[model samples]
Target: MRKISYNQYQFKVLLYDVPKKIFILLFLFIFTLILLYINLEKSEQIAKKHERLKVSESTLFIDNILDMKKDDIPKNSIFFLDTTRMKSPNKVRDLTLRQACSIESAAVTNENVKVFIVLVSPYKTLDQVKYTPAMEAILSYKNVHVNSMNLLQFSADALYDNFVANGNLLKSRFVKQHTSDFVRMLILIKYGGTYIDTDMIVRKKLKDLPSNFICRDHGFLNAAIIRLQNNLGKKVGKLFIDDLIRNFNGSEWGWNGPLMLTRVLTDLCQTSNVNEMINCNGFHVLNEDICYPINGLEWNQLFNEQHASKVLQSVEHSYFVHFWNKLSQHEKIACNSSAAYAQLARKFCPKTFSLCHEYF
Candidate 1:
């Protein structure tokens, strides 16, 4: 007030600018922090989802679960199908009727062979009314089993029961339907038998099948269709099953253990200390079309060898077709009408042809 000057006016202006500058900088810092927080949350969620989808627990020796020593190698195998799996899922995705028929046809070809049909689910419907006629008319082979397992095991397992009983597991797990296969595979490794699935329809009878050639057509030795013939010790199979039981308690992939089994079987089928009868590097048949199933028409991959040449084809003259033809009621009826399918269809449902015409 005594000496108001130009310098004093300049100082006042500078003071005024400081608060405004501070406010702007503070606002920017807060906005940037908020953006960073959102990005971090989004990144964390993606990481968690990826972890859940694809993680292999097989190689990792889980604590307190059955542990296998390096010496516990070498084993034999068999082929069996657990048909009971078909009913477990709300949507029976991969194990279609056609797939089941193929397996039946394949197993039936060997009259003297012992085939185990593994099924895991509540013994709800025998499906005998639907499949019995088909089985009786076309297949008369013996040594074939209708191995059905109790669905209660999933619930009875103490840990898995709660989720499985509530249908929570059913919603997320597509391979629960194939639970029988896993069990059978373990049985084969432990007990020395074959494990196959119902989705498979055998075109070739494995009578006097070469002990250790990788299978063809159904690409990869689909555990769904296996040939475990080596006379390995009982402990071998137990080791495999233990893996299943442990994995089952830990995560969902036990319901769908492809990569895991692939690693295990490949190793077992390879350098193992099993009896000398065990073929070194046994066959791991990998036919890309193996995934095609019955309903599938055209195959995408070209083979250097056609099935006709390698004794590699399925359902030869002696056995029935696993007609993996997943068709609608209309399609099934139409299929039954064809002259070729007519004989096959009528053989089972004596009146199949008439039924097809009725639909018309």
Candidate 2:
């Protein structure tokens, strides 16, 4: 046999063995690309499905709003607006126990008055939205009606009807606060009914209050509770709405809210004194204690076990109890605690109180 050189032997091995190794490597690379392509395709499909589901939910919500009839909502209704924008069923936009307490107390005290909880979300329907135990408790009342309304649609006419369309409200640093201030005024102008803030707990029947009135809070008229009625051919609600729109300023926080009410009442009554405003025909200004028994400076007293009795006793003669939620929202009131808020919730909004497992 002829002996081969080392170089020729290596050349033969490279030609024979390298082809098999390269073929295997090429096959693996192609397989990995195929697997990656399949996974990417599945991910795209799932994303499309999720998008479609969201569209379906939003469409249903819009349909529900369109189905609502004007007659379904009573003229003497009490309106509470929920301005949260809900995104999904898993992310339910239900009321907190404290907020539900406000509604429950109102429904319990004003059994004869229709209570309308207007949801200002355009993407979630009442039927599709999940209800918390607190929300269900309030909804058990026959007078309570949970309805959906598109904020943009409802504000369309109001925005175009006045000089407020200048986008001052949209430019505010506190957009939600300003929007709420404007919406409450628009609701009063359009419906002529009572508008109560979600932070208030009703202590007495609001239906029996003056036809058109607002409560005073620390020298300024508060819009927290407003009962406006068109009577004696005087469109007092409209006048306020017009004035608010004409003098719209989004720079200051409460300028469009409590402060605006003060200015408007002064203009309407042609006097700066609260007593004179109360004497104004077809309009009244209630005393501060009637609604805000505890000032914002002492709002924590409502949640103090030691001061519970004192706080309760002070508000005994009051028609409403404004807890200054803005100042006390982060302060938790323990369930069944001796805090004044707990006691009041237990007595006035028992259902909401009972549903709370821990701190409210």
Candidate 3:
């Protein structure tokens, strides 16, 4: 190479350094953009994300407790619920109303009995759960406790395999219904409490009924409203767990729910007929009028204005009115309306009716 002047050599070095300088600047710029994007993403979703809240008598967490033994539950516990599966706006509204109605009914009928509503995952605040209105309404009551229990807690450790297997099948299909079906039994078994579906309008204090009992609906044993006693309740609950692990039929709807209850009770009692509440082994079976006065197929009767008077009469005599969320979640029970559901909502769950008027 030809020898160059000092000025030219200096210029050449500067040229090389200029690109390096530019590359460093460019890299920093891109990194800054990335960080900005990430923060923005989190900020935008914070509204929908779970927030940490205090744990109290009325608000608690069953988080990370894999082996929730039966004794872990309280003796005075008589109510349990689930609303972790529903996600849609309409469904959320229904849950809010359902929860409101449930809390109101419990407060009115059985102020002494505590009602616990379980959430799917952990969250700090009800606002982060996407059903803030309903959650707040439920929490507003003195007897209602809103809590979060990890799905794994229900069947973690050695039972992990069975829990994940059955849960996976349910998650892909009926996330809300089947999961509710499976977990409700576990909750009842663990706590020996009454499991009431959110869709139903509670008609009376749950403790007024037998301590250990299940109801019949449409000539089939229904798990919608069930009260599990201590020893026998634990036995039936164990059977439910075993059936779910060994013979869980995710393909057939209600296999883990009503149908499973019918099969287990029949075998446990060694009885052929489970259509009516039979005083089997230790638990009693109640007639359909106890929890499901209206069959699932004719759930519309509650929302039909013409059936308003009749539905009112029937629900008055029933323990709870099952609205069948699958069929009636989208149906509006407008406030100050003539619909049977509206009438019931106003009379039983006034806050829920107000929310329906405000949100729906």
TM-score of every prediction relative to native: 0.45, 0.76, 0.72
Best by TM-score: 2
Across residues 1-360, which tens digit of lDDT does each residue of candidate 3 receive? Answer: 999999999999999999999999999999999999999898756622233243443432333323334444565565555545433322222255665676676555666776666665322222234435665565566666555555554545335435654446444356566667766766776566777766677767666687778888877887877777678787877887678656666667788887788778878778758764488777788887778888988898988889988888886788888888777778766556787777777777766566775433
Error of 1 at 271 (Å): 11
Off by over 4 Å in 2: 1-67, 86-92, 122-128, 157-166, 232-234
Question: Judged by lDDT against the true structure, how good is candidate 1?
Answer: 0.40
**After TM-score superposition, what is the CA distance of residue 286 in candidate 1 from its true location, in Å?**
7.0
Worst 10 residues of 3 by lDDT: 122-131
Query: After superposition, which runs of candidate 1 have C-alpha atoms over 4 Å from their true positions?
Result: 1-104, 114-118, 122-132, 135-147, 151-172, 189-191, 210-221, 233-240, 245-255, 265-333, 336-360
What are the per-residue Cα lDDT tens digits for candidate 1 across 26-76?
Answer: 999999999999999998777432221212321111111012221222232
Candidate 3, residue 28: Cα displacement in angstroms equals: 53
The local distance difference test score of each candidate is 0.40, 0.74, 0.66
Question: Could you tell me the TM-score of candidate 2?
Answer: 0.76
Give one digit per residue, the lDDT tens place, for model 2 in 47-98. Answer: 4332212234223221233355566556678998776552222344668888
